[model samples]
Target: MTPVILTVFALTYLGMILGGLPFLKLDRTGVALLGAIALVATEAVSEQAALAAIHAPTLILLFSFMVVSAQLRLGGFYDWAARRLGALPVRPLVLLGALIAVAASLSAVFSNDIVCLAMAPVLADLCIARRLDPVPFLLALACAANLGSAATLIGNPQNMLIGETLHLSFPGYLAQAALPVVLGLLVTWGLIGLLTWGRWELPAGVPAPSVHSDERGPNTAGHPEPGRPLNRWQSAKGLVVAALLFAAFLFVPWPRDLMALAGAGLLLTSRRLHSRRMLGLVDWELLVLFMGLFIINGALQQTGLPAQAVAGLAAAGVDLQAPAPLFAASFLLSNLVSNVPAVMLLLPLASAHPQGATLLALSSTLAGNLFIVGSIANIIVVQAAERRGIRISWRRHARVGVPVTVATLGIAAVSLWLGVGAP
Candidate 1:
């Protein structure tokens, strides 16, 4: 029974690493959930143990932020930003810089995926109007979103997981991450600058687009009505909750997860939007994905994986003491399996240093820029570009991805070496 459960667990996570099972219809989420159910049926883990392994604190923090992001999305704030960015009267190069900075900055504070989802179409139309290639701009969106989310603990799912699991200091993590993040943005700008010049060139004296043309023209009958106007009052309420949540991170002497849950609860007391509707907007799929992975991984841990795999690494004189091997391992796994699941798989080994957790957070999150599939933000931008008759081929993305990943990871390594690891 133990071997059967361990094999299923390994296969499930291996499926995660492969992004899905071959010749099968299910995705990573389905694979993980099924793995957990398999453990229960095989009696390797009791229902109680399975439930315990699915840490509720992590789930609450994840769910609350999803609600927060959902509120911002429903409020039309992201849509407004998209249309406005589309209307900028700047050169393609300058526009690319602005797009990257804005996208990354917004992603640091909110959900990167949501930012891309709302901004992609607006950017697409804007590029079409300017006769400048949207491909570079869309790629900038992906790269910048990944770069920006690295700046904050609440910025992305993996960072949040690392924070809860490792008990990392929120402000300190930001300070440690600030330099790589800054250098990353600059490198991001440079890469986008080069790409725009060579691949996205438009003939000189082609006037920059006017704001009107980029606005997609006053509501055409064919286009769907703007997903309701930006709800200022609801938006304000959500913002207040967000501000309080951030304050909780800084000054409040409570678990960050509970504070976030409180803020989410505050938003739920509205008379207009149905609570169910608001909850429905939360990415329950992601939460389920996390829970399933946790149970699957927990079962693997019970199988003496450390003695089998980690001890062998030690036997080969490979040290996991500092961030060197761990960093390299995480960098590869993030690209191989995606960051969130990678973090879940590795967090068990990083429970030593107060900064170890933050290291796992930063390395996994930033390593995402290494390739197109390294992060969802990248895919979102590419898909959005495709929809607009633009194409951001993998080769085009790699030109930017390689340098950004190398530079950011270098900074992260040195930071860890010098004991500046998120203390």
Candidate 2:
């Protein structure tokens, strides 16, 4: 049984690293799901044990936020915001800063992936219409979203997991994370702006309509193909609920999961925005992935091998409980297996350290800017740009991602050393 669990765990994480197995249609979600099923079927983990491994609170909070974000997407708030930013009569660099600020702020409160999904396409069109190069803006959007999400626990999936598992205070985590996130965004803007300074204009070879053209004016180009028009009432309702939930998270002694669930309930009962549309936008695949990873990881923990390995490492003078080593481990593991899985593997170590949760959350998230595949928000923005005939290759992404990641992680390390947001 131990051997079975180990094999399953190895193959599952390998799938994570490679993004899938050879000669299969499986993705990370599918791979994770199959691993959990394998564990249960082989009796490596019993049905009851498997069920117990699934963290209900984390899943509920994630689902609730997905609903809240869906409400905003369906209300056209994201599209409106993108177009408004694009239409600003500011200098190109100032516009870049604005885009970064907006992307980061929204991602801190909403799902960063969803924010990218909603804004990227419209932004691409706007850039093309204005004869501005879209690549830098797209990259900034991805980087900002990732960096900003680090500021709040509910910003990304992994942060939510860390906060719920560790029972970290929302405000406390915010204080710890705020400096790194803000400075990271600033670094992203500066690095991207520097790299693309004189080249902000679209190349002559790239085909795009002129800003003065009647057929593809800035206003028309920035507006995404008519989806849901902005519903002030629905958007306002979602915002109010989200605000109240945020307040409760800060002030009340209630369970964060239930508070979030209640907020989602309010959004789902809307009259104009059908529940089907709102629910349809939810990332059910992500929910399943979290559940599968939970079960598989739970099985691995039962095998006691991970504990033994940690003990061996500690004995060798590489203590992961210390802030510096933990930060390094979090960054490497996050890029290696992606942030959520990395956090899942590291949470046990974090449980013993006073600042484990903060270090893990910041390092894992800030590390995501290292590559295109390091975070889903990056993928979302890249894919969205590709659909609009704007290619952002791996080499292109790494040029910005590498520096942004290094600078942000440095800021985080310094903040942690200074005992900011220390629990």
Best-fitting candidate, scored by TM-score: 2
RMSD of each: 3.8, 3.0
Per-structure clash totals for the candidates: 0, 0
Which candidate comes out best when scored by lDDT?
A: 2
- Model 1 over residues 1-423: C-alpha lDDT tens digits? 678877887788688777778888878888888888888888888898898888888889888888887777666677667666767887677777888889988888777877887677767766666676666777778778887888888888898888887777888888888777877788778866865666575445544433333334334466532233466877778777888788779776689999998888877877887788788878777888998888877777777865478778878988663567778778888998899888887887787555677678778988888888899888887886665455678887898888878877787777767766344
Looking at model 2, the pairs that clash are: none
Residue 152, model 1, lDDT: 87
* Worst 10 contiguous positions by lDDT, candidate 1: 209-218
Candidate 2 residues 270-365, lDDT tens each?
Answer: 778889998999999999999999999998898888889888999999988877888899999899999999999999999787788988999999
lDDT (C-alpha, whole model) for all candidates:
0.77, 0.89
Runs of candidate 1 exceeding 4 Å displacement: 198-228, 419-422
Query: Which lDDT value does model 1 have at 373?
Result: 89
Worst lDDT 10-window in candidate 2: 209-218
TM-score of each: 0.90, 0.95
